[model samples]
Target: MQISYLQQWLTTPTYKIHRSQLRFWFSLSLTFSVIYSVLALELAFRGNYLIDSDARQHVFWMQRFLDPALFPNDLITDYHQSVAPSGYAALYWLIAQLGIPPLILNKLLPTLLGVITTSYCFATCLQLLPVPAAGFIASLVLNQTLWMRYDLVSGTPRAFIYPLFLAFLYYLLRRSLLPCLIALALQGLFYPQCVFISSGILVLQLWRWHKGRLCLSGNKQDYLFCVAGLGTAFLVMLPYALQSSEFGAVITAAQAKISPEFLPGGRTPFFHDNFLEFWFYGKRSSLVPRLSRITPLIYTGLFLPFLLWKSSQFPLARQVTPKVQVLIQGIIASLGMFVIAHVLLFQLHHPSRYTMHSLLVLLALAAGITLTVSLQALFNWAKCSPKSYPWKGYLARGTTVFLAIVLIIYPVFTPFPYAKYKQGKEPLLYEFFSQQPKHIMIASLSEEANNIPSFAQRSVLTSEMYTIPYHVEYYNQIRQRTIDLIRAQYSADLTLARNVIETYGADFWLLDRTAFTPEYIRGSNWLMQFSEARAVVTELEQGIIPALSGIMEQCSVLETEYLVVLPTDCILKFAQRKRN
Candidate 1:
């Protein structure tokens, strides 16, 4: 008797109740999005010295927007700024005009983006299934998945993709031509790779499955819509294709294959020995990366087709709109781009980029519909059970309630603050550099150099974060700089150190306390790639104290527990003293 009432409440709402259900679900979806985003913001602002891991690479350069004096003629800053998408840069510049520095804005922007993504996702789910409850579940799943990933919280160009892409999907499904074109244009300006996926979807829409075979879409409106979308896509993508980078050409697969930067422990780590990892789960190469972790309940989406086949038993399945084909087209478009990206290699960026965002959106819709259908099925079974089989009704009701409880409480057990915020451990180290002249460049072989640019707002000669090797010209300079720094840091002669300091205009030398030891050299994979570093290890093992170490007490300007900073003038003076 209770089962019938529950089914009626879910499936047979009056028009006024249905409107209220829509309002309730939409509000819930937005509420969850706000909650997740607030948690990320908490970590982002938890410490004055914290930054999102990727923001250290992409956003550090944006500090120049507020003050042009920062990172002047800086190679690391220049390369990153040049590669930033125009629209993304402009947005930051505009925000900076309003006096919010990019780093602070970067921390706050994700909440707004998350809210927009939640709004569009909920509306799009409604177009697919027309069930307000399903929309809530879909947006809920998408929010949970996004919060777990670094992409959404990073506030980089890719963060714009979710809202822009979902808006494109929603507007297209609604047949709103102008809005869809605008979404496509914005996506191109923010993340151009998604324009290809949008184009692929437009092309695929030109066909229709009729009877047993596929044929061209009979409606003229379909052709008109697709042609307009494709034309807009072409216009937005043309600038990226024609424009050449000052950093020279993107590294080819042949080039990356030979470089240590692409090896197992290398910076990028693209080529893996494990087949499953390389083809299926590799961060760069995979078709669908992090499948299980995408959403805890994503596996339920796999049962959607089966449930749809038994639609008679799952009454809610019949309410799924024909527009659900948009989900299928999205999957095909993502997969098609994924395959093309692999064949073309890094030219399209990473293959995983083509699929991961779209996968989350598609799976969320499928899983939401599946959850609603399954619940209704259980309720139906309970309602139809014979009086003799009272236990069956109890089992059905228990299962239905249990599924709902798990879905609601799943987030509490999962880890929090997956925002991947990297905190600066050496406050003294950053304070030291922050006080230096803006033009001053610090030279270092220590991993701590990676955090210096963002935390100290000062330039470093080269650090692990700045060693991105996608552009041949930029990386070649970075590689040589690394080699030179390694040799100078460990050489017994002060002459090599003097030459490197002069060549890079390095104002200071930063060193780890253990920098002179052989174990330090042996443990650093980045340094070991160069023969100079390996030779230094051999020298240290033979009890050859480096010239820099011999003068450490006199040359040191500032000393911390783990680090020491030496002025270049001091090093140069020591070289002169040794010559006399």
Candidate 2:
């Protein structure tokens, strides 16, 4: 095909779109989604091994289900295992039983999910606007947006939200009751917070705004869909509320507000002193977050309403389906939940959850349509050569081609991913720790502690990244553990160090070369969450000699340039020998 012919075919018309055109557009959208996903999956394979950072907390424990003895009697293991929803855990367990390692599965799942998510996104956009290329552009932009972040690559429970939620949207648009319910059930099963969001959207469907007045929908089918979808949400969510966890009751909103864990600089910090940010613009609390900035293609979505309103200038508005209003309903539902989440704090989980998913999807659809309309207008105008400037046609063609290239590669070429999709660095250290007995636990202040569980298949007393304080029983234990570990590390007294060892069954005390320095405690965001870390930093700055600092050289079991692993038993033995 000639380049001009191909360009004209791809550029969707503002009016008179055909059924065959829709099929071709859908096929092209799927092809692009596959290409983008393949490029991302290839990045995962660039290293000898790679692990998703979020998977460190969520997926590592699944290794135990595959082999019963992997993390026996381990606090971190048992807690992470308990917190995982039954379905998410069962899926990983089933995969693990089939001889795929959890880490391996994590690497592979993202591509499949990306393709699935893009497919549904395209179908959903097609329902909103039958111009097939509009759906094509929207799916392309959505896939690019997803890839620029760790959302897809993480392959954690949160990763399931895009595909499951998009599938629900697509099914709802098609009025496929059974599949819609199944999507709702699967979302509840994996990411339960989304079930509430889905329920809110479903509830909105029953209400309609008619000519300046609010009224219920005339369709009985709307009520029927609402009842079935909402009922499924309640049934799936009921188990979480009814079942008592060994970790005890869920932490109330009041409890979380006072806890330093929610303060600025702390892990999962939601309450910012800056009122604007706390209410509307926090990274985790914001309506859209940094996604718009990361992928500037989303800005095009703002122009969609303008183009749509002036239907004469942009006849693409004629192709729009009233069903497109469902996305607006999703946005309304998302914002409602975001505010409720903020008002209730951690009670509804993170406020960002409400907006990020819907807003991104909505923006992608609108942006796709906007760009499609722009390219179509430009190409159609190019056919009529201006009498004076023959280069006008050539310039239009170049601009369209450039825009397509920029959209396709927008965030992939960025130096950093929008989300922190970390990979473990120290393979030698991981291998060394993996050789230890299954029951042995390590104590550390190193940030590397977060990566240990997944990379080494061993447990740590606590890690900065894994400190999600949603349960009173769990948070209390973790808070105390953090205090004790910090205090024991800096104590000049041998008695306190031995107490930490006995209290938590610390088989090994892992220390970084700079672990006892005051700056280490003061600078770390996670350590500041503990009441003990502040005092420890002050005491160390006062030039108090540390007991572990002295014993680290004496009881060392393993040594690397920056890391020192002191056997707790060896330290106790040294103390006993001195007493003798």
Specify the highest-lDDT model's number.
1
Error of 2 at 482 (Å): 1.7
Weakest ten-residue segment in model 2 by summed lDDT: 412-421
Whole-model Cα lDDT of every candidate shown, in order: 0.86, 0.79
lDDT per residue (tens digit) for residues 174-203 in model 1: 999999999999999999888988888888
lDDT (10s digit) by residue, model 2, range 171-273 = 9989999999999999988888888888998999988889988889989888888999999998999998887788867777777678777778778776778
Full-model lDDT, candidate 2: 0.79
lDDT of 1 at 169: 91
lDDT score of model 1?
0.86
Clashing pairs in 1: none
Instruction: Identify the leading candidate in terms of TM-score.
Output: 1
Show how many residue pairs clash in every candidate, following the order shown.
0, 0
